[model samples]
Target: MSSPVAMIPYTNMAPYRQLGAPRDCRFVPVVPRVSIGALLSGEVVAAAVPVGGLKALEGVVETVGRFGIAAEGECMSVLFFSCVPFEEMHFPRTIRVTGESASSVRLLYLLLGSIHGFNRLPHIAADGRVFDGELLIGDRALVKGQATAGEERHFITDLSQKWFDIHRLPFVFARWVVRKDAPGPIKSAISDWLDEFKAREASLVEQAVPEAARTLNLPPAAIRRYFQVIRRSLGERDVLGQQLFIRQFEERGRSLLFQPAP
Candidate 1:
């Protein structure tokens, strides 16, 4: 059998690898946490790794081209649903979080701390009944974002948009990455796909929407709006955002991996 690649099970991610990759590129649906394990264990050569967790994967894998999921202002997914008013939120209280993307959760914490002056940010587990807020990511986030009523909309915080509001830089959520020690064929295939994707991303993503909409059970227009906000290729500002996020993550003492104490 051919080598596999990890695919994060998110509707927003449909514009990436699903658009087109080599026939040898067998895709296996994996979540953010397990993706690294799959890549390192040789279960997969490449994965649509989370930018939030990028610091963790350093030296283990390298990002490919500018191919990634980024948002200039609003991601429309990766939302924080606060039980109380946005301004009234203070995190001595625990917030229920979906155990999905650590990256998104971290971004939430960063925003809560930096922008909101909330130093005591603690995202509790899903089972916790006593919580001040709920963090929803991926497709469910999109649904809640879409289905929200007038006043309810005031409470939902879009993490990517919040980042842009504070930093004025595009926020990248995930990117295609390959193991540094991956087989030549795997790396070469990803490189070739990146080359092909350079020009085709805009058009290909548009064309793929109907299918993605059907598969994801979201409206085609909603999908279009999402793609409108989502930038598949990272640019200078996007890189800046990544750097700032890493710096902040590390400074907050939430470094992804172990390091020597200085």
Candidate 2:
């Protein structure tokens, strides 16, 4: 049988495999924003796609919300700026990014600009050369300070923390979405598999990274945090949180889903 495809950036997805899940479950790690566009366009099928993507594809009927990744107070992971003293930021400047991320980067901007009250700074995609501040999410954000005690300057704005502060609940980042046209058995199987996988994440993380020392890099640690944030952001089968998130989609005023699958 062909393996199921899991698209997300978090590295803590291994537990799903360990828990008698499909070995064929191929994980396609991607940034939240753009990936959702592609998924809604039918470029891809199932993914832990961003909330933005979920908004685009709403009413497709096959998709559903799940889980939350909570970061109470301040998440040490998912740092926003690459430099210091966030209150005093350079404005009207173009910041360079690696050109791989989409959602978190923009989401960071909204959180800082719209909510946190920072001046709008345009993001310029550059091949190389670090800017004064850069938003680093997933594994990189978790272990960013490891190299030589801060060679790179970063102001840690925990996205999840800010989200909870505003929403009074966990922020929903992504969801497990099945295609509307997908077979019923396939959807049911995936649903069952996800439930089992969710239960096993805690035990897996314990064995996977028993010591916090191993997490100072953007590898496994970031992956762990990604899972952590996602789990916390979702609550009560994500019914209430999803309704709130839907408004965010409306605010963007973009078509969340493609007419036909990409």
Candidate 3:
């Protein structure tokens, strides 16, 4: 008998889960966007991956314009930025990153350089940076936040909100993708799973770490509201969201020759 697979939830994966059970499959806890490069490089069959991973796939994708994880106005959860006052954030300071996130590192850099006009910051692994102010994402955001908040001595920015403020649209940090030659059935299954995941998010929320509530300093009710916000934002087919994503990325490409902000 095959082993029972555990379906691990991702930050942006709720939409997939809402689509429902696969006919003969058990989903597992594959993290977000980490698999994009591998899948496109033919290292894996399929994955929900970032566009950067797509570019890293060694000339596999000729054009990356058709698909991505964009939304119209305020995704709320993704794309975070933190900093001290311009006076305090020692210029040429080494920025530490939460080690777990593969996607946000690139996402953070693009938003900063493109949207906020910040240039020339070096990336250092989490352990190497001794400073209290550093960008973090995923489980670490919940796990280590309270201990570091305010005490870190910096002004925090949510890149999603900032993007929304600037352009009045949602940011698409990544996308669900497969190799161009991948089997059609696999793509269909993945799409179906995403639909079910979005529809049944309430069920998933119950299984979430309660510590997240305390860590975010939100009550359970507020946590539920937060998830609701994510659902509402992602599910909408708002033009504003897509426009924001395309405009920023295209503008950057024109100026910096960037591939995509995955």
Candidate 4:
């Protein structure tokens, strides 16, 4: 029989890698969307899928464990760089959504519409060159910083930070999931792996900092600070935060999305 496959984010897999790749499983590094596709196709038994895409996987997949990527206040990787301050911006603003993560895109919309009260929704710009604002995620966002050009600096808004400002709760970006019918052994393996990761979380971050800094072309101290904002465990507070987000999202007339599968 073929080994069960596990999908992890390409840029953020370092910490997982430090925990040591599971011996009996194959690890596939992919973006959040690709991971979702692989999970749907059964090509991968487990994945860390974007929270936005979780809506589509409601009955199809189950949470593997309490392992996920979330942010308490600031997440350096998901940012909005705008020519003007967000509060001063008006409706119909042209915004470039990153082609990276689905969850971040949805989170941006949720924030703008629900929290900021932009009822008309901003226009999504197809060309980055023409955009008044841009949503950037992952390494690209980290590298861009304030997204300065010559003497001009953009107004930078960290989405996670914004979420916290309104909700005072951690924002979950992605979560570990597995096919509902996955073998018991595979689930057990994943749970064990998460346990190991949680036990050695600090060491894992330390080991990954240098490589992450190199990859993102950032200082090691900055990288360490970035990791500090990321929340790995879905504890009570995190769960409450997620629920609050979902409620607010639904109140905005969005469809019912993401009930964790049993």
Which runs of model 1 end up more than 4 angstroms from their true locations? 116-118, 122-130, 149-154, 255-262
Residue-level lDDT of model 1, residues 96-116, one tens digit each, is: 666778578778777777655
What TM-score, over all chains together, does every model reach? 0.88, 0.70, 0.65, 0.89
Q: What's the number of clashes in each of the models?
A: 0, 28, 21, 0
lDDT of 3 by residue, 1-262 (tens): 2212223254444434554445444555655544554555465445545544444654453322234454444444453434564223333444565444444555556555653354434334244345524665554453344344465544665555666666665565555544566566655655565555556656775544254466566566645544554532243443455444555454553333222111
lDDT of 1 at 182: 80
Candidate 3: RMSD to truth: 6.1
lDDT of 1 at 160: 89
- The runs of at least 3 residues in candidate 2 whose Cα sits more than 4 Å from the true structure, single-residue gaps closed, are 1-3, 20-34, 41-44, 59-61, 68-75, 97-102, 115-119, 122-130, 146-154, 210-233, 236-249, 252-262
In model 4, where is the ten-residue run with the lowest total lDDT? 253-262
lDDT (Cα, tens digit) per residue for candidate 4, span 113-228: 76447455666655434767878888777778723533365688899999899889999888888898888877778778888889999999899999887877778888888778
Worst 10 residues of 1 by lDDT: 253-262
Decreasing TM-score order of the candidates: 4, 1, 2, 3
Compared with the true structure, what per-residue lDDT tens digits does model 2 show for residues 1-262?
4444545544434344345543334455555565666565655556666554554677653544454343443555556654555554445334543244444554555555554244344444344644556666655655653342345454556676766677765555556676786566666766776766667668765555533335434455545555454453255635555556557645643332111111
lDDT of each: 0.76, 0.52, 0.48, 0.76
| Root-mean-square deviation of every model | 4.3, 6.2, 6.1, 5.2
lDDT of 3 at 244: 48
lDDT of 1: 0.76
